[model samples]
Target: MAGGAADNYGGVFDGSMGFGAKPALILIDFVEAYFDPSCALYAGVEEALKNALKLRDAAREAGLLIVYTNVSYTQSMIDGGRFAQKVPPLENFVAGHPMGAWPKGLEPADDELVITKHYPSAFFGTSLASTLTANGNDSLIITGLSTSGCVRASCVDCCSHGFIPIIAEDAVGDRHEAPHKANLFDMQAKYADVLPSAKIMEYLSELKL
Candidate 1:
């Protein structure tokens, strides 16, 4: 860890948040646009999607509280606010748009918690924080698409909200490898404990939830 350029920075961001029993798994922005090769937002994130589904299965078997997020805007796109303006392609997520739908295997079950937002950070204007707190989830395992955008934003917000964020590296992705890898490094350095999917599964094994 000391050999990297990031090592020059003070130890202010060093240290892990460790694991907790009541961990909730968050699968962020896995909409069809991210996976559909024909879509402009597609990133060929097949590997990340595979890893996420595996973790999703493991979480279900372990009976962990799972949360899913998707970007949904009104047909008028007025509800999208500033973020939607920043990324005009986000118009795909507007109501009636096919790209807003979650991919087949990753769709949330009827009982699973669903958080809809028009912003990057899930906690920005959503009830995710209160919901996780109410469910007694002191730790959050985040895995999803676009590491540099929503994933990074959600990781920082998750930490700020006082929940230990465990970012599953193998299960998160981006349109390109560079930003994906860069964000993961920065996140591990500043905001969260970045772990591979296998390691997260190990943490899940010991949980009674």
Candidate 2:
């Protein structure tokens, strides 16, 4: 760890953590396709979904912007690229499929933002950055499934876009625990602020969101 943020769990502070400002929330790939028991991301979907609900409530009460990233591909674009070849199973996630819909109880509110992405990184080839910038959001509280993939990619891109990426460790999930733990460690080491939800909530409460 280049900075002392890795010790932040015990009340250590780094000026870079971006706590006081109102943050936007980005929930990545929490749809039914990822939740299906047959999918590779299924194992921890239940836990992720529960945590996502918690994050949504907190963000809503804090008056922070809420954004949801749903991974969907049109049937015409099914054979897109290397990612599709690497995981042919994803072709089934075409738009309009029931499995591709946002999971029950997790739909975005009318005023919230919904970004449809064909790739893992939410900011890649999407309007996510512009949307956040337009709202004057400097910090993002991110949570969702498959922590090593979409979550990590989003965190890195969030930083690149000049926004602080705060990865809520407990609020994220993966197909297995090892990748989740490893990615969280790696993301905290260089790209983002990885912390538990309670501490983040405390920071947000004091911010005047």
Candidate 3:
């Protein structure tokens, strides 16, 4: 049965921003902390990573500009500010920490851009918005860790910066299913066009290089 909430929000939040003429694929914070079982921030989201890799491959084949983000902080953790205080595990991203490193296959190519951010949103305190604008990208295909946190934040900022945000639903994961699903639903309703990774791959396949 369809949920009453979906019915309640029908038409109001069902609009789609759709894909744009120039879309960039941003693989956000696919770092070792979320992948390593022993890490405090481990999300056990291997499937999300797998799907994101597929998206990355499709974007590469489509010749779309690809961007990657990772959180980093100074050794003193001073730059992290209250965010670090709120989530002590963020120390995992301090410079030279193994958890801060990219996992095996997710490393950015030499020519690809990598943005280091101190906050949840990739655009905050980073060159992402300017870089995207300079590259002539009109939309962003966002995929990343923790749907309720960084992914949601980035999606909102992506829209606020005048770019259409297309979220790869299966390409983002949280520590639990509830926040993940809730954030996806919320983002779909308010900030982005949340579509399955396969759908996004299809879109990429149809794009002209």
Q: Which candidate's TM-score is highest?
A: 3
Candidate order by lDDT, decreasing, is: 3, 1, 2
Residues 56-84, candidate 3: write the lDDT tens digits: 99999999999999999999999999999
Clash total of candidate 3: 0
Candidate 3: 10-residue stretch with minimal lDDT: 1-10
Badly placed stretches (over 4 Å) of model 3 are 1-4
User: Could you give me the TM-score of model 2 versus the true structure?
Assistant: 0.88
lDDT of candidate 3 at residue 15, scale 0 to 100: 90
- Per-prediction TM-score to the true structure, in the order listed: 0.94, 0.88, 0.97
Against the reference, the lDDT scores of all candidates come to 0.89, 0.81, 0.93
Lowest-sum lDDT 10-residue window in model 2: 9-18
- Judged by lDDT against the true structure, how good is candidate 2? 0.81
- Per-prediction backbone clash count: 0, 0, 0
Indicate whether candidate 1 or candidate 3 has the larger lDDT: 3
Candidate 2 lDDT over 1-209, as tens digits, reads 43665565434333356563758998988888677887644554687778778878878888999999887777866535677667777765777877778888998899999998878899999999998889888889999867998899999999899999999898888877888888998888778889888887777666684
Candidate 1 on 1-209: residue-level lDDT in tens? 44676667568677787887799899999989988888889988888889999998889888988999999888888988878888989988987689989888887888799999889998899999999999998989999978999999999999999999999999999999889988998999888999999998987877785
